[model samples]
Target: MVTVNIGTLHNVLDHVYGAFMHRTKISPLFFSGGWGGSKLELLERMIKQLFPEVVGQNCPPTLVKPVWNTVWETKTACLREGVFRTPCDEQLLSALPPECHNARVAFLTPKFVPPQRMACVVHLAGTGDHTFERRLRLGGPLLKENIATMVLESPFYGQRRPMMQFGSKLLCVSDLLLLGRATIEEARGLLHWLDSEEGFGKTGVCGLSMGGVHAAMVGSLHPTPVATLPFLSPHSAVVAFCEGILQHATAWEALREDLAAQKAAMTLEEVRERMRNVLSLTDVTRFPIPKNPDAVIFVAATDDGYIPKHSVMELQKAWPGSEVRWVTGGHVSSFLLHNGEFRRAIVDGLNRLEWKESPS
Candidate 1:
């Protein structure tokens, strides 16, 4: 009899898939759009100014309602597509490219759930996830469990992608930061609307890959208790961009030259370190722990190429009482094959939190 390590097998597949896509010409390199010029400086300054206000504010920021259109309908659920101006403040707004000036979202909810038992989960976008269908599909079945789905379109993706950007290959370092910052603001606003407006009895936020990172931030910064689910996500963008498969897809030469132009002439290693420094701002572990750490769940891949187990565990450790569930598969495999597990995590995480008190 032979014992096989299924995890190693899938991990190899991930490595092969990543290498073929990144090592060859199949996928365009990230940051190929070159440096964002002044936007980089603006983002750096704003992050210092804005992180505390948005994430650590004394009161929640004002929320705005979206103008929605019923894009699709069905017997069990109706889907409403919505458009709202981006909620990022003036300085950050000016940093965004015109195309991403507005935020877009798709929401799917069951025809009915008792007001006390109603639930809604906001799904953030992962890299290259350009539409709501995939996220909706993941959250759709949960409607049976009375969990609605709200899919946020990440800035620099879908209808929000900038004119000069190519596919998932972000044009500049600042573009990446701006996208994350704007996403936090918009997601926080939507969560606020869901809690204070729609009044879902229970609300949670979840995402996979890059979206997972954002989900963790939103969950952490949110004023109230909400289930936080991060599936197949690293503790920080530093891991994804500097230490994982994405490193191959990074435009090292462009970054080196950009850093060189920013300060004194720089070497390739110096630029890599600088990139690490910039991406460090995205470490969710560095963010405040959610009010309900017990309500946080991380669904991680056992053999993920992009997100190492260490990164996932690091976040779990930082937020004590958060649970980590290990599913057998690699990054791509887990995303494609383990959605049932992802859905299960969402249900369990949401269940851990107390229902929000309904208004009079």
Candidate 2:
């Protein structure tokens, strides 16, 4: 039997990741149609208007309905996911795709002592159908700790995914931007709801991969006092789609080819630039720093090909005084390799915050 060299295998995988990034293409449609200079400017303006303050005092509270899932019952806490219709301004809705207009936000909240403090972790799933496995794996530890864990279903995912689209594939870049906008807005609403509730303690937001990116944006935009923890996420959407593991996905390639053939007049670089601008709305650096920079924790993987090291560093630099914990493995493997340590860090971080804020 021949033995495989683990080091060599890792190097090969790294090389493949590099190739995927270089070979990936962007679509002109991402730049055109309601995403031009004026439209993009309008989008940015709208986001700024919605989150005028660091704390989302302007956003209206949304009514959340908790739906019990008996299948996920645990001794520590009652398992239930809350659903709410994401409220959006009429102008914002008109600008986004019709499918995203009526999108909803779903979150898994552990029932306990009214949660002295709640850590609303937005557990974003990768490019696929939303799975309970990911939710439990990422949010379970927090629930066990009695830290009311709430996982927000990213827009165009779970119940929000369009009926015609039988999977998590977003056919157009427009849809992805709409998803970003909806999730950001919905998260603001949730934060407001948490703050409005009597006796609800501090609320923190954390996310993994795509969800991490959303958490970063939400943390920066929401003015409320929240601990922001973004794990396995890049600073910019451009890096995520252009240089991340998502470049290898078949859906992206198909969309690229379709856009290439349809918009031959536009060059790849032009399309890329436009897409980057659209995604910049959610870019962590574009927004304000968190109210408490020290409360922001970033979990990064040294060997993560899905999120380039530079992107993670960008976010770190953007938020001075923020802490980072490095794991040793690629995107997927790092989750399993450092899950225990990551969970410990989260629990400890949030607990420390709670203690520090307690009356002396």
Candidate 3:
């Protein structure tokens, strides 16, 4: 009898699902609009400011008070839905499509909370996550553990999606960078509001897939200690667009055509290399380790079709003192099967941090 590797089998399943979902003939694919022209350069200049020495200083207030338009009480918690204008600088605001200018969030808090005993974790959006429902459900069980959950609607997703773009297929390569940058700014602001205004005892940021990458960036730039949890994320976008299952989903011909018309034509291989160069800007290792490195925890799959083991290990290696726990499944299966492990990581990471002493 031949032995079968369960993890490998799961990986195969993920690829099959991915191809059917993204690579099929009828679907209008992602990155179809190609590399954005002038819009991309502006974003690049802004993102370059994220080095270890100056990031904290550069980020300023990006949100006014969010108006909570909806509020209701659950049996054990309170829920609020609110909207706020994205606080990006003028250049970014000009570049962003009007539909994506405003941001939306859902907040859930436990009813019984003492001033210094509560913890809140902001959950960022992953690919195709158009609403707060999935994340809210993930954080629902954690409420018994006394942790509140906040979920943000990513730009170009949910109601914010551009009318011309298809579901989950971001129009251009630059659009991805724009989404990450905007999410970081908004998430940082929300965490600050929770701490300084709402007086939360401890705060953290967590996300899965693409949102996981953005969550890591936000946590790294935060001035104080925050539990930084990135679940099923790669070290860089390069791993996804250049080396993983997403390569098939990309619009290579469109990218080549755009480059050719703009400045110079490029071979398909050259276009791939260009994609690598652009996505390299998203490498998390390039950013500084979090203020509290020990508070970082990574949850990875044993066999992930979309993210390789090396991608997860690289970030852990770069940020020493960070912990990595492996769940026994591939990318898709792990996402569906491992909410418990993810919650455990969130609790464990938050526990590693010492609470701010009641502001002395």
Which candidate leads the pack in TM-score? Answer: 3
Residue-level lDDT tens digits of model 2 in 60-154: 44534333344455655655555455566676676555555544334455665554445554454444436545656666766656566555666
Looking at candidate 1, what is the lDDT of residue 8? 86
Per-prediction count of colliding residue pairs?
0, 4, 1
Model 3 CA lDDT for position 263:
76
Put down candidate 3 lDDT per residue, 213-275, tens digits, no spaces. 999999888878999999999999999889989899989998999999987777999999999
TM-score of each: 0.94, 0.77, 0.97
Q: Assess the local accuracy of residue 187 in candidate 3 as a C-alpha lDDT between 0 and 100.
A: 93
Error of 3 at 2 (Å): 3.7
Residues 170-264, model 1: lDDT tens digits: 88888889888889889989988987887788888999999999999889888889999999999999999899898998999887777666688
Ranking by lDDT: 3, 1, 2
Q: List clashing residue pairs in candidate 3.
A: 260-265
After superposing candidate 3 on the true structure, give the runs of residues whose Cα lies further than 4 Å from its correct spot. Answer: 53-57, 61-63, 358-360
